[model samples]
Target: MCGIVGAIANRDVVPLLIEGLKRLEYRGYDSAGIAVIDGRDVRRVRRTGRVAEMEAAAQSEAFSAQVGVGHTRWATHGGVTEANAHPHISQGVALVHNGIIENHDEQRERLRALGYQFESQTDTEVIAHLIHHHLTQGADLLAALQRTVKELTGAYALAVVSRAEPQRMVVARMGCPLLIGIGEGENFVASDVSAILQATRQVMFLEEGDTAELSRDGVRIFDGNDEPVERELHQSDVSLASLELGPYRHFMQKEIHEQPRALGDTIEAAMDVGFDAALFGDNAGEILKGISGVQILACGTSYYAGMTARYWIEAIAGLPCSVEIASEYRYRAAYANPDHLVVTLSQSGETLDTMEALKYAKSLGHRHTLSICNVPESAIPRASELVCYTRAGAEIGVASTKAFTTQLAVLFQLSVVLAKLHGKLDEAEEAGYLEELRYLPGSVQHALNLEPQIALWAERFAPKSDALFLGRGLHYPIALEGALKLKEISYIHAEAYPAGELKHGPLALVDANMPVVVIAPNDRLLEKVKSNMQEVRARGGELFVFTDQDSNFSESEGVHVIRTPRHAGALSPIIHTIPVQLLAYHTALARGTDVDKPRNLAKSVTVE
Candidate 1:
């Protein structure tokens, strides 16, 4: 994922770096660029596609500068062209990157053996020719970006701009996400806070090996022994008018109607401070009473919200959970149970494989991490020791609805505070599961009032191409997050089994033009998900269900039911994920696609 923005200003910082690259264009829109400096030289503008075509090619040049840097790119080592865009300039420095400089081919062969002539197969133009080869040997610009980030390794979040330091803007981060943004005379830097949350909600958030410079009067930070630190700004309740789309057509239907106010502000701060396994660390109730097992990691819809919290932490935190998939748990080498309580999940806790799988489970000695994120200052909650944020604000839809129902309402309030700290629920069954999480935002507003009956089954699934979803015990990760929100915004070709694995082979790809979609939640797996929806209506599959009106499944002909007004026992996967996120936002608004930037997908993966 890419998207960066920087500014140092008293004025024309190229329209605040093109409105913070159009609010971090959902973290990467193929290509876009900007550089600025100007007086002493840098001034650039590249483009390949969106950021409104690089803001109409920076209004055909003469990009007035007050110091800048910007980018939008999502290309990794190189391809979406305008010569692999980004600010990536060289001699006069100018940069802009988001992760993956993985030893940029041995530092681009030691800056091409010191003659440095590369153009654009970018590892971000080899960090602008190794910061113009350490500012042409006499190191300056923050010691040539701290000696070209100590000769680079992996994951970055750079932002640079020099032209002999025309006012300033230098940034860095090791894993990914960067921040800053306190303004007035002007200072920013991004990678997201919804691109400086419309210029300043007083940020900071740059931790893992931080570095900063930004100046038109503030931000200094540096550490990783470059010393001078101090970072804690924080005033961001991110509201660019709740990221607008006011009457909603898409920010995925204004985050599927802001999932009942983002699951009532993520379980209303654990129902106002009661559910506590020490609210996740004051030694989290002595690590939830020495939690024996439970891994999680995540990716994609937070790995189906850690497979629906491994069925609520093994059915109400009796423990023994598992989940993985943080980019295959950081290249597969297992058995790291130093009292395994490692958890992760990331709405944009800069997920570079869930922050390298929580630094490979803290290098195999796990020591109880936790992150259930929504950016309490990213990098997996600053490399997790404990966190739970998921306020689920600012999702900016790259296919995630209210951050997967506020990370399943913070993994069902960390499985009811680890099932009441492992006695497996006491105190009136944890006050009846905190009064069913304070009545789960009215059962997710009765599943967003079944979005006009799932938009009348998304107008019969917007001319279906293929679909299947189904469910069973624990609604099979809510039918694999409703076939990954209908193949992430209706590219269709969906699938999801576990309705007793549908004849162990996906019922040979169900017929009558697919469309099975069950998740019939009434509980005890509703007659084995109604005999797997009668084996997808005895083969002419075309059922749809999403049940709950006491699930005696109805709608006669080929079966279609919509239900979901009540029965959310054990909080039915956050109320059946709001009618599977309004049937993938009304089937990607009936196939017009781009349901909030869904082509190649990039809300935040922060590069592999």
Candidate 2:
């Protein structure tokens, strides 16, 4: 996923565009560039590195413009070079894009036959040339973009400008995220609202196959059918300060520390008004009564959250549950029943794989579709029949921190809600569960307090080339998440296995050189986990145990124990998640790696 920002205003927009790109730096990018109309021609500055370098170049060259479009690109079809950077220009038409163009090679061949020259190895350059071709054939900027997009196939969010139309810009969204920001005497476009939040709080999230023309006058939108349409304008409450790294060294660290507040806010609606099936939608109660099972589709960390939910649903609600990775699920032949509810989880609801999996389930006659997402306006929530919003706020870090914990909090609530509806939980029992949810934020804060000790443990883990994570029962998914966090940020090789499976094959690789991390929360499976810990110990594997306060684990010989607050039943996974996050954050710090924007990883996976 890349970042796109555009503005049409009376004043110079170079500063605005640069600041927007900086705000979007957390999305992960290899190069940054901007294309602006200077008087009668387009002036461009491209860099092969960070946005700061490009900004410095723009300043040294005295580049200024009243209308412009900027981009931060994560390499997809091209190498990390300035020649392949965004703001790709062709015949005086310049554009920046996010998402893949599936038919790029075909289009490149067709354009080449038509005497159009290509400069870069990017799918985006084809878009610039195609639009310019249409403009040459007597089409306006909006009409040309409309004509150009019709020939392209695949996901893309495009922002284009032309030298002939200095005050005009056009933006389009096919299957990727693009939005228009409303400002006084000025309008903006960006892949994420956070990029334009400094200039405008009012935004309109464009739906599939929507294009809009932007100018100092106003914004005009047209639907897929080429007819004028109106989309709702939402007032974003994200503050400028929330996007900043206040007091923390990195956004990942700040987000890790914000887990308590994030969890509290995510479950606030359930806590305040009590859990009604209507909290999900108007007909969720009826839908819940008719469902015999749940089929969850998700990707990455959200998939792990779904894996954890599988344990909760089957045990608490007595419902059959299956968790499938969305990317793989879409390619396989799977059974989808109308009586089973299809649930999709994504932090940025625009995750293409999960969205496609939801469509595939729908195509197979599944009717009850629900989505758990953080961005309320994102595509998945809007596409699903029912929705649950996780209010984790803006998760800037490429490696998720707050978003993962908040997803677990929401999934836990869903489990309890299903139990109550199925007569598995009575009034008193439901109240007890609610009480546990009430104290969750404080429990998370207690876990946050373990940061000091975990940071010390991280120093010991920093030099290790590989690590093993082990857990049992409901905590096994927590182990998987821990290993993911470590590998994502620290670049260390890490793997997780159910504790019982450790003896089967993974034991052969255990030795003093390998560090073993175990999740031991004093549940019924505590003894089983302790047995696995011994298996690692016998092999002389250095052990790091994150246990509960009363678990009575001691630091002796090769064993190191970091205790969290006493386990909260059913919600222990969310609590155990805290220490592992801090461990990864601090480990990345000690290894001198990029924690916020991890290499080769984008915050949002907009393309499949």
Candidate 3:
């Protein structure tokens, strides 16, 4: 729930660190700070607001240092204040962290007993004092970090520095993301790729329990056993052009407009050449072969993604799939069998609830776990046997546009592969599915071109304070996601219910002021969804329906129907999701909130 950036250069590193923080603003923006080394002393600058505020503060005369580490924070453990902002410092150790310290109380108590004083209200400040404590005990920076981290509990991705040792930086990761970018006489580290993409594309990914000691010249890796380990350095291959807005007003708007290319990238990269039965490879499909059912665990947008996947699994793969929010999955014991596959979906793949739930599933002997994620090398992927990664690249906006669609695509593709492998789908049916998959890229582009229709709809209804989203079966989760998006950024009161659930309590909330968004996509559930639309109209609700022109939904009463391509219901989850994304993007812009970085929300959920 925070963004961290660090760098050391033969030249001054403050400017590079500032640029990296600007890139990371999408991750978090509530408070910002940077601590830099000035001739073996640390000078700290911090602000209690956006990155621009901190940049303004840093440019003042008093704050200047050579080598630095910075952070933009989303408050998790403490109130938002300038002192609570990251790059928390002690006498010499200045630290930037991205995850929560679950046992910070113990660490704090121990540090206090050792006569160390804390200066801020954050779990991260304990790390500063702990590192300082170890260094005071005559330990070197790397050894002090190693020994200090051993006493800590819970997930973390920490980048620590010591003015006592000015030439190098030490980093360690447990369940959070940390990457090192190689540069010419300068090196960089960040919680995500977006921060360091401008400096270097070549990076060394830090695995769990691995520590990296970085210097002006190079980086060295060591394992938990204190043995030197050789690491493979991969050149990050993402195109920088995808990160640009290309004249769009906001990143949310640019991302909504980029859905066509994003979907195209996912589908094109997913096509397998042969009838090979190994799409869910690396012993992941063995869960299906070994299990009789599936339990899916996820949270928020990914939870909706899981709900959509449940429909495909039941309809296409002929498997029973249980979809549950991960925060609730552990509290209740479900009736399970050994043959149950636990699947999880996450855009960042580091969501705390989902990660903990997956571990609980494994401990319960649910051996088969599959993860669908957009980011490569995310924490959840490391725990799963089979992982289908969405190559949608870096999604910066807090309200996900591409990652949600790509998760469904990957899940759908996985279901198809499983159906073929398990003999649930024959060769002819498989070929038909593949043919539909081929048209996806064009269909997504077509839907994107209809943004004018969505903008017009927004103009018609942006003044309303509340809305109702209705769908059925696979479209049910799409409506839920649509409502979540509107509520998340626009601060609008939005509720989604299964189209059939209108009379079951949701109808009581429908009125003249309520604008209803009915997803009338052509599917087996079309008639039920149409009847639901009429039910809403009977209650004096204005209808804005998205449907296929080829479908009979156009003739439905009391609804303004906007027609899109008539794709299969399985494909409609990705195609029909476009207009709702547009509506939220426009509505947030109308409400005058930060569309790209919504308040109290971060792009990546790094901490629990």
TM-score winner: 2
Candidate 3 lDDT over 24-116, as tens digits, reads 888756898899888978888888887878888888845665568999888888798887888898887899988888999998999999998
Q: lDDT for model 3, on a 0 to 1 scale?
A: 0.82
Instruction: Please give the TM-score that candidate 1 achieves against the real structure.
Output: 0.37
Q: Can you write out model 1's per-residue Cα lDDT over 1-608, one digit (the tens) per residue? A: 67888888888878888887887776547888888877887778787878877787678775787888888888767688898888878878878888787778988887788888887898888888888777788987887887788878887889887778787778888877788888898888887877767767888888877787878988789897799989888898888987667887667787777777877877776788878876666777887678788899888778887887888878887888889788887898888879878888888777788788788888888888888877676667766788878777877878887888778877888887887777888788788888888888877887787688788789888898888887777778777887888887778888787888799898998889888888777777688778778877898887878778776766888987888866867878778878887887788788888777877778888777
Give per-residue lDDT, candidate 2, residue 549.
Answer: 88
Task: Provide the TM-score for each candidate, comma-separated.
Answer: 0.37, 0.99, 0.95
For model 2, residues 207-324, the per-residue Cα lDDT tens digits are 9999999999899999998899999999998878889988999999999888889999999999877767877888899988788899999999999999999999999888999999
What Cα-based lDDT does every candidate model obtain?
A: 0.80, 0.93, 0.82
lDDT at 545, model 1: 83
Would you list the clashing residue pairs of candidate 1?
1-607, 281-284
Q: For model 2, what is the alpha-carbon lDDT of residue 59? A: 100
Lowest summed-lDDT stretch of 10 residues in model 3? 270-279
Top candidate (lDDT): 2
Candidate 2, residue 570: lDDT: 93
In terms of lDDT, which candidate is stronger, 2 or 3?
Answer: 2
